[model samples]
Target: MFDYSKLPIRNVLCLDMKSFFASVEAVERGLDPMETLLVVVANKNRKGSVVLAASPKMKELYGIKTGSRFFEIPVNNKQIHIVESRMALYVNYASKVIQILEKFAPYEAIDVYSIDESWICTDGTEKLFGNRWEVARKIRETIYEETGLPSCIGIGPNKFLAKVILDIEAKKNGIAECKYKDVEDKLWPQKVEAIWGIGKRMQKNLNRMGIFKVGELATTPLNKLKERFGVMGEQLYWHSWGVDLSPVIQDWEFEEEQKSISTGITLMSDYGGEDTEIVILELCEEIGLRLRQSFLQCKTVYLGIEYSKDIGGGFGHSHTMNDYSCISNQIYKECISLFRKYYQGFPVRKVSVAVSNLQNFDNLQLKLFDEENQRDLSLSFALDEVKNKYGKHSIFKGVSLFKNATAKERANKIGGHNK
Candidate 1:
C-alpha cells in the first residue's frame, strides 16, 4: 500500500492528433477528417505498401488501420481515398501544433512525444487559461480552427497517467481525466496489455504470473515484481498505482554526449548478399556523420538484421573496437564483421546500426604510427563539411552509386517517406 496524499501531483495533458497523416490529407482536400475515408500509405504504387494512417471512418468500415497492407483496402471504393505519405507536410503540421501549445505553456513545459503526440504541463496556467479541462478545450478548439485538424486530450496528475488515459479513454470520449484516486476504478479492470508501456511480450509474461489486470499488478508484492522483471518490474508496479515521478517540464534537446548513435531502416523490398552489405555501409555513414556532427566518437559498433516478417527472426550483435573513431569506414568494418558473423542469409527486410561507448571527439588519442587512421578521421570531417555546405547527397561514397544502394533515394526523403 502507498500513501496517495504524499505523492506530488501536477497537471499534465497528453494530446494526440486523430489519425494524423490521414487527417492531414483530409483537411487538405477540404473534407471533414472524422467523416472522410482516407488512408495514407508509404507507397501507393506497391500492393504490399503498409498503411501509415487510416481515418476513423476508414478503420470502422474496412478494418484498414496502420500496418495493414495496401492491397487490403477495398478496390474501386469510390468513397475511400488513398494517398501517399508526405512526411514534410505532416512535420510542418506537427510544428504548427507545438506552436499552438507554446501559446498556453512555456516551450520547456511541453514535450513533443512524436510527430502526432505531445505532453504539456499546465501546472501554473489556471489564472490565464482556467482549469485543465478548460485549457484542454481551448487547445483542441484552437488547433482545429487554425489547422483544420482534430485532436484528443487526456488530463491527469502525471505523464504516464495522461498518456494512458488519452490512449484508452480520450480517443473515444474526445477528452478525459484520470486522477490518482480514479486509477483502480477507471483502469484496473482493463487487460494488462492495455497499459501504455506493457507490450505483448510483457503481457504474456505477466499473464503467466497470473497478473492479468492493472489492479493485480498494483497489488502484487514489489519484491516479487523486482525479483521477476528487475528494474522494469519495479516501474510497472509503481505505474499501475498511477505513480509516475517523471518531470513534466525539462530540457528536450538532443544531448551532445549521447548514450548511442544509431540509425535503422526497413527495406522496401528484401535485400541480400552484396546488396545488404551496401545498405549496412550506408547506415554506418549515417552513424559516422551524426557522431562527427555531435563531436562524439564511439568504441562499440552494433548491427541488427531482421529477416522478413514471414520468417520472423533476427540477430543483433555488437563489437567493441580497440580504438574510438568517428570514421565511416571503421564503423562499417565493425558492422560488417558482426553482420557476417551472425547473418543467416534470410532475405533481410530491416537493417540497423548503432555505435555506443561514446566519448568526446576531443578526447580521441592519436596513434603515432597509425597515420592512416588520422587521415581517415580528417577525411570524415572534410566530407562532413562538404555535406553541410552543399547537401547530404552532395558527397557520398562511390558505393552509394551501386544499384542496390539506397542513400541517394533516401537523401530526398523524410523519415524514409516522401518529403
Candidate 2:
C-alpha cells in the first residue's frame, strides 16, 4: 500500500558553477587562479553597480558575495582588484549552458537559479546515462570542458534536498549523495539558514523560536509552521526533512496558465526626479518588445519602482487597459499613462515593467484604426526570424537601443562557441 502520509519526490540533479562570474572573468583575462587578488565587478560605476560576481579566491580575501555593494568592503590593507561587470557576457555564457543542459534533459524540468546554477530531473536518464552519480559527473565535466567553468553537482531524492546538499553541506565533504537512508545524517546537522528556502527574514523568525538548526526545523510541528509562515511555512517544514513533491518538469509552458510578462533593470545609479519618466518609457518599450516576442497581447500594465537601498517598501501601480495588445507603440502609450499616475517621489534604483491578462493578438481582434497593431505584428515576426537564424540579437526593436542591456550585450558578443 502507498503511504499517504509520506512525501514522495525522486531523482533530482543540482548543478552549480564554482564562483561563476569571477571564474568567467578569470578565464577571459587569463588571470592566475592562485593569485591572492579579489576580483569584484558591477554594471557601470564600481561603487554604484551591485557586485555581480566574486571569484573563490576573491571570496576568501574580502569575504564578499554576489549582489553585495562595492563600498561595503573596508579597504583591507591587502591589495584587491575590481572589474566593471559585463552582464552581456554572463548572459551569453548562461544561454550556452542552458542549451547544453537541454540536450541532456528537457528544458522545462530544469530549474534555473541564476546565470550559473540549475536543477534537472534525472529519473528518466538512468537507463541512457548509466547511473545518477555518473550522470552528475558527466554533466559537470561537460560544463567544465565547454565553458572553462567548473561545476559542483549533487544528486538526491528531491530537488530541494539536492540543491541544499550541493550548495551547503556537500561543499565540505567534496560532494554529497542523499539516499533515503542517509537523509537524517546528511541534512540535519546544517544550520536553519543553510537551507535554500530560508532567508534573512525567515531565519530571524526561526531563530527567535530557538530553532537554530535544520534538525530543529525538521522536528518542528507542521501545523505551527503553517501558522507562522502560511503555505510557504509548510514548504519549509517539508523541505527541512528532505521532502519536495515537485516533479522534474520538462517545460514551464504551464506557467503561462497564470498571466505574466515582464522586464526589469537595475540601474547604474538612482534616477529620481525628472529622468524617471524617460526611464519608465524606455522600460515600457522594452517590455513591449518582450510581449510581442512572446506573441502575447496584454490588458493590464503594471509599474513597480524600488528606491535605492530601501528594501522595506516602494511604489507600484496597475492600470486596466481598454484593449489588449502586443503592439509596442500602444503598450508604450499605455505604460506612459500608467507611469503618469504611479511614478511618485522616489530615487529609483530598480524598475520593472509587467503586463498581465495576456492573450493572442490575432484572436483579440483589436481595432483597425490603430496602426501600432499592424506595425508591431510585422516587426515582431521579422525580429523573430532574425533572432531565430542569427541568434537572439540578429535584430532588435529600436526602442530596445535606449533601454535594454541584453540587446547591447548581444551586439557586443561577436564570436563565441554555440552548439
Candidate 3:
C-alpha cells in the first residue's frame, strides 16, 4: 500500500484568469468582464471563426464560451457585445497580472503555464501571507484591482491537485482548497474527463473498464492500470488519487529540461496548393523562434494537418532530424519534406509544427565539414538578437513575402488571435 505520509506535500496554487480575452476586452472598454455579456472572436467577419473567450455572464446566460463559433453568437442584441480578439493587448495585460503575483511569491516560485494560467509554490510563506486561502484571495483581488481581470485559485499540496481543483471547483466557487482529508467528498464525484490529466480518449478507455467516477479509479489495482497503460497508466492512477509530485518550474529555469516545443495555427479559410507551404514555413519559423529564445536546438520535428472536420480526416506524423538544428530555414525544410510525404490533396484548415529532443547551445555538437551549417547557426543567432531587441517582425525572410504569408498579420498576436 502506498503511504500517504511519505508523499512530498507542498502548497501549490493554481491560478486561472476567467475569460481572459473577453475580460481584457471589457477592461479596455471600462466594463467588468464578470458583469458584461461579451464574447471575443478571432474574426468578426468570419462566421466560422473560433471564439477566443467569452465573459462569465455571456457563458452563464447564453451557454456561449470559448470554442463557440462566431456564427453561434446572438446577433442583433444591443446588450451583448461581440468583439474581435486583440491578442497583443491581452498579452500586455497578462504581464501586468504577473506583476501582481510576484508581490506574494518571487518569480522563482511561479510557473507561468500559459497566457492565462500559472502554478505558484507557497510552501514557506505562511508567516508572510497568513494562510493559503487568504493568499489565494489576495491574488484574485489584486489582479482585479490592478488589471480589472477576475481570477480563480485552487490550493493543493502539488501541481496536479492544484490545477484540477481550479478547473473543477475554484473557477466557480472563486477559490477552493483540497487538503488530503477533502479527497473523497471533493474529488471523487467528478467524471474522469473533468480531471486535469485525463482527456476524452483516455475517458473512453477508462469507460471500457467501467471506471466512470474518480472514486473508482482511485481504488483500482495499480498493477492492472500499469499493465494496461504502462508508465502513463501509473500516472493516471496516482493523479486520480489527487497525488502529484511534479514541481512548479519557474520561467527562469526552463532551459534545464528538454520536454517539447510546438506552434500551430487555424487558418481563416481552408488552404490548398502552394499556400500550404507558406503557412507551414510561418509555423516552423515561429517554432524556431521559440527554440532559439531558449538557446536550444532540436533533433525531431512533427507536422500535423487537420482537414476540416466537416470533411472527416486529418493526419499527423513526426520525423527525427539527422542533425540537430534551430535554424528556421532548416526546420521549414524538414516540414516541407514532411508535407510532401504525408499531405493528401484536401482542403487543409489547420497546421501544426513541433520540435523536440532539445539540447542547449552550450552542449550542441558541430560537424567537421559544416561551414554552411555554421553560417545558418550564426544567422539564426543574429535574428534572435534583433527579434528580442526590436520585435518579431523587425527582421523578415524572403519567404515571408509569399502570397499566403500570415506571419506579418500575426506579428502582434499572442496565440494566433488578433491584438
Q: lDDT per model, in order?
A: 0.91, 0.70, 0.85
TM-score, structure 2 vs. true: 0.76
lDDT of 2 by residue, 66-170 (tens): 877878655554556666656667777889888878877777778897777888887788778767788877787777678777678787887777888887755
Candidate 1 CA-lDDT value: 0.91
- Error of model 2, residue 217, in angstroms: 1.9
TM-score of 3: 0.79
Output the TM-score of candidate 1.
0.86
Question: Residue 43 deviation, candidate 2, in Å?
Answer: 4.2
Please tell me which predicted candidate would have the highest TM-score against the true structure: 1
> In model 2, what lDDT does residue 152 have?
81
User: In model 2, which residue pairs have backbone atoms overlapping below 3 Å?
Assistant: 42-85, 108-250, 108-251, 109-249, 109-250
| Candidate 1 local lDDT, 148-248, one digit each (tens) | 99999999999999999998999999999999889989888888999999999999999999999999999999999999999999999999999999988
Over 119-196, each residue of candidate 3 has an lDDT whose tens digit, in order, gives: 989877889986888899888888887887888999998898888889988998999989776778888898888888
Model 2 scores worst on lDDT over the 10 consecutive residues at 410-419
| TM-score to true structure, per model | 0.86, 0.76, 0.79
